[model samples]
Target chain A: MSTLKIEDYDRLRSKLPNRTGGWVPGTAVYCRGYDMMDDLVGRVDFFQSLVLNITGQLPEERFAKWLHAAHICVSWPDPRIWCNQIGAYAAMARATVNAASSFGNLAADSVMYGQGTLPIGTRLIQRLHTQHLNEKKSVEEIVDQEIERKGGKVNIMGFARPLASGDERVVAMRRTAKNLAYQDGAHMQLALAIEELLYNRYSETMNFTGYLCAFMSDLGYSAEQVHRIFALIVVNGVTASFSEEAEKPVDSFLPLRCEDIEYTGPAKRALPDMTDE
Target chain B: MVNRSVKSRKEPFVKKASTNIWQEQPVEHNPYLVEKTHLRGYDFDELTQHCDFTEMFYLLFLGELPNRNQKQLLQLLLVTFISPSPRHPASRSAMSLGGGKTFPQHILPASLGIAGGEYLGGRQVQLCMQLIQDNHQIIPALWLEEQEARLAEADKALLAEGRIIYGFGQQYGEIDPYASLLADKFLGKSFSGPHLTWCAGLVEELKPYCIGWLQTGIVAAVLCDLGFPPHAGAGLFQLIQAPGLLAHGLEAYPKSRTEFPFVRDEDYDIVDT
Candidate 1:
């Protein structure tokens, strides 16, 4: 039997226990102890408010500006990208802008790439950081062990990206970080060491995710927080792709012929008798 | 800059997407227009004329029509879990969005997104399927003994705030009676496989701890018995429960937003952290 009593469930029958703030409808809206109208409206940038809402801690102005730049790096308005392709298709289908953007964001929640990989990438980097710092493991050992764990395939998450050998976004973000006068901390240092080893040995360099996670980790963000912070990092690009297609004629975005899809199933066969089985 | 230049990995992506489930033949006049379509090599016309939705649904996923027992089990399971109760967060989202007169198109996606969460939803089904796949080989009692330490730790958290062991645990401080009821619908059926049987055994072992089969666990077991992979578990669950979600959403679409209770300011307890 459970140790939990009925009181546990009864304690909040009609009540919502909110850690975050809510509105009084007539009075004022509160967000993380700051009055939304009075304190946050014209005071902080949207990125700062976003971080405040997600992490309950207001980020520094420069850090928010760095994040704003980082979002721009990932969200290029290229419909060739998978998530943006969804946006383009949605626009072609005459979906509402909200629908297009929402569907496009959903498409990015994939395990392989885009926003979905943030949590996994964050976890991997955080684990590698712990191994380097707490366990006194060398960067070489960290890289080798990760490769060995993957059966020596050299398919580490941060180092290798799909469809490309090197990530251009990382280069852009590096410039952004430097412009913001941010210095590489412990996690970033460890990441650079790993990236250097991988690049020298296997021609693979760290991706934008690697750099972002390391930078955020140094600022005391957990893996989950990092994931939450960057959930819609690709939304702007998706919306841009959608807007372009929405302005164009319908059904014109990559219209495909019947033969475009290859059917590899069994050849035409008659259906079996329903009663025969 | 790195020693090596940035270049495409030249991954061998297919020129045309291929599928084993559907084939659309083009008309002679226009390649953009489909003349006819076949599903799993069966004529669409013939399938519409002969097969029921359950068989067609099974064929769509499994690439073959279900057997007699499979059809019966699937049909029953579908009826049993047509809607995930109005109290479910997904249903609440649907109702809320519907009543608020948000575009009809946004309702399903919004509700389904909420339905995809890890708690008591499609993700739970996926995890439960994985759990059943991983540990169904061992005897339930022995498996329980092996996991005793983990279970004890989980129990502490469970009392504090419910923790589902993949998909089997308390809901609202009690074992979910409806889960067993749903499981019983297919427990001794001919289509029921070892995964379901093993889960039944596991539930028996879990009686002392008060954790039993959650609805997700039952769905997971049934899907496993039906040979659907773990990745398919979430999507299948969502698809199965979609009708209820859409129906409830549409039902609330025309109603005044005040038809549903909105929590008052007093009820919304903003705790200081």
Candidate 2:
């Protein structure tokens, strides 16, 4: 394998045209919508290559396949709740099957809000809405009255809108999305998928994991799929850097290069660095 | 302690319900709150360090610490992803709306389009970043003043065009209570430099304009502190609305084979003529 030195990485990044109209390399790609996959043809398994290229670590075939499936599935359908879009549903189903085949844990609990609680909550809220209308009270007035009656803080206002006329479909959708956002592994995959989707849709980029859940939920993707996809992406993308010279370029240099590389390790590493404090 | 307080407050709501319907219903849980006991034999000490906001952000979603290279890659990814694009679809949407001509109608869609396009969590962060970069201590004041001024300008433009103000009246009959709390959270404590003073001034200037919309004041103040730039405010709004969107998405997902049937609406009829 052609090892990429730190200097080489730096040179490539610096030489790349600033397509994003900003000084930042990443911003350039984001603004220009430069599809990385297209540039690296015959590398359809971009996720695997990305793991290797960026971290110098290769993933197992099974792991790579699972990751790819998750990626494609999560990436297919952009989340739109009110519109009831279903293009991504097939992808999600395929991802679930791939995950089950690759990982023994197929029936992992969804990270979203408990499926059991959503229906009742929505129904109850709907009932309250109806009661308010019956009493000739506005949605806000009813919520306030209820808060007062319940002696609650009433701090978070505007929860009494009758936006979903007790429609079982809408209620169910809301519940599933909420649950998916909170689900583990699945949430991760979903987040990654959304990240890709957003990049594709908006032609803007952002931190991958930081806003994964936020992005998935915001774009109207299936939260359950997001949770699962996030988990798979994080696990599949894991890599290690055996060198300590990583910080030298980013901190002091104007830009990083491949020649500056000096890390070597087979030691396993995680996806996020969590030792700041 | 905070959790306990919140739980105690919710007890009444739980009790008031005639039955345990709420408990029986599916409830979404925070994934981060993992059960310590379930993590047996896992060497958490071996995990990588999470040092900065970016690192913490990754851990929060990915559930594991990243190594040096991974961290760098993630950073590169973020820098590539988060920055605004000049020719973004949202920007196009905004441009098509005709700046200042349509006012709220134009601005809201444009902002939403920008936000939706970028997937930004909130415009507040972008605004805060801008203020901090421009003039630290005066950020708050400047933010308040600018927002109010923009709002007034928008309102005036709307009036001239014979259109009603957007996001002005309370749709739910009351102001958003969280607005003040959020403002205090973002700026009330963390801000102390020249930006803080500026924010105070802006608040004073804006108070008159926010006659009935008290929440606007809080939103402006908080967004200022959060580092969002004026152009990015609409994006921030979209970002904050992510949770709501996610909730809707999850609810729509089919839980089982049986749930799929619910998706079929029986109301529609096809004409074969």
Candidate 3:
């Protein structure tokens, strides 16, 4: 028998319970205990406000600047990328800007890349950091174990890029972090060590996921928190692609000939007479 | 300078995407135009002339026309879940979107997303199908006993907070009456297969705990009987419920924004952290 009483659910029948803040008419709006109108508006940067909403704690200005750079690093205005391509297609079909942006953002919630990889990547780096520092495991052993876990494939989530190896974003972000006076924490050091080993042995290096996971993990963010923070990382790129295509003629993004689609199904055949009539 | 040079891995991608589900014959004069089409070997014109919508739909998915029993079962299932209740979150989302004057085309996708959620939706159906596929060999009563043991070890407060076993569970602290009735309706049909029968027996074992067939469970069982794999079950649930979602959305599309209740500020409580 369920211990739950009907009244437990009854209490919520006509009410909305929110931990986050809401607006009180004629008073003020609160967001995570900070008054939005008084404390946040025109005071904090967008990233600080975003981080506060996601993590329930306002981040430092330096961290917000670092995140701003990270956002720029990810949101390249190239429609050749999958999520941006969706935005281009949505524009070609004359979808509204919000529709194009939203649909493309949804597409980026993918296992192959973008925000979808953050949780897995963050968890992996955190776990490996613990093993290397606390458990005194060598970087070589950690790499071997991870590769073995992936069925002897060199397909660790953070360490490898999809199209091209060695991520340019990582180098750019490294420069950004240094300029912001951030030091290599233990997690970042462990990531660097793993990248060095992987590069020497397999000719593969850490990607942007690797760099972001390590940096965020060092700053004490959980996998879920990091994933939530970067949920709309590709929005700017998607919007840019959408605007360019939406400005042009309809269905002109990549007009495909009917012959462009290759059909390998059975040759022309007659349908059997319908017996179910 | 950054030492790493970004180079293409040169993965061999197909020049033209290929599809076995559809074949469109190009016009002789212009390859850019299509002259004929076939779906899984059945000519489009012939199918349109001879088959009913249900038959054509079955052929589209299962690659062949369904028999009379299969057709009847599928049609019955479709009508049974024609529209979720107005109180359902997906329906509410659709109504809300329509009331908000969102793009008419965006309504279906948004509502379908809610319908594909983990609670009482496509994700639950997918998980239930997986559970059935993975554990159908075990006796139903034994499986219930195992679940009972697992629940006993779990945090009591958490378990009481609606940690359901995918397809079978109580809604509002009681067995969902409509779900129970629908289960019986499907079980009485001629085309109900082993999967449905097995799930019915499981529902019997669940009665003592106030747990029974959920709508997702019924959908999962029927899709399993229809020979769809577990991964396809979620999308199938979304597709089956699309018409109802779209209907509710379109129905509210012309209504004023105030037509739907907006939960007054007094009704909303914000608890400080």
Task: Give the winner by lDDT.
Answer: 3
True contacts kept of 3: 0.74
- Clash statistics: count for each candidate: 0, 110, 0
Task: Write one digit per residue (lDDT tens) for candidate 3, span B126-235.
Answer: 98898888888899999878888786676543332223567887776678899888888889667888889989999898777667788999999998888889999888
**Rank ordering of all candidates by lDDT, starting from the highest:** 3, 1, 2
Q: Name the runs in model 2 displaced over 4 angstroms.
A: A1-277, B1-55, B58-153, B156-175, B187-201, B211-244, B252-273
lDDT per residue for candidate 2 within B1-273, as digits (tens), equals 000001111222221213111111112363223222101112234322314655554443344444554455444334333323323344434433433233322333334434432122233334433544465445444555556555555644332211222222221223334433433443433233333345445434534444222232333333443333455444444544433333332333323435332212222222111
DockQ of 1: 0.64
Tens-place lDDT per residue, model 3, A18-124, is 88889888989999998999999999999999999988999999999999999999988999899999899999988888888988988888779988899999999
Model 1, global lDDT: 0.86
Over 4 Å off in model 1, which ranges?
A: A1-5, B1-5, B155-164
lDDT scores for all predictions? 0.86, 0.34, 0.86
lDDT (10s digit) by residue, model 1, range B30-111: 9999889999999998999999889998899899988888898788878888898898999989999999999998899899
Every candidate's DockQ is 0.64, 0.02, 0.57
Better of 1 and 2 by DockQ: 1
Runs off by more than 4 Å, candidate 3: A1-4, A130-138, B1-4, B142-150, B155-164, B206-210
Better of 1 and 3 by TM-score: 1
For candidate 2, the per-residue lDDT at B60 reads 39
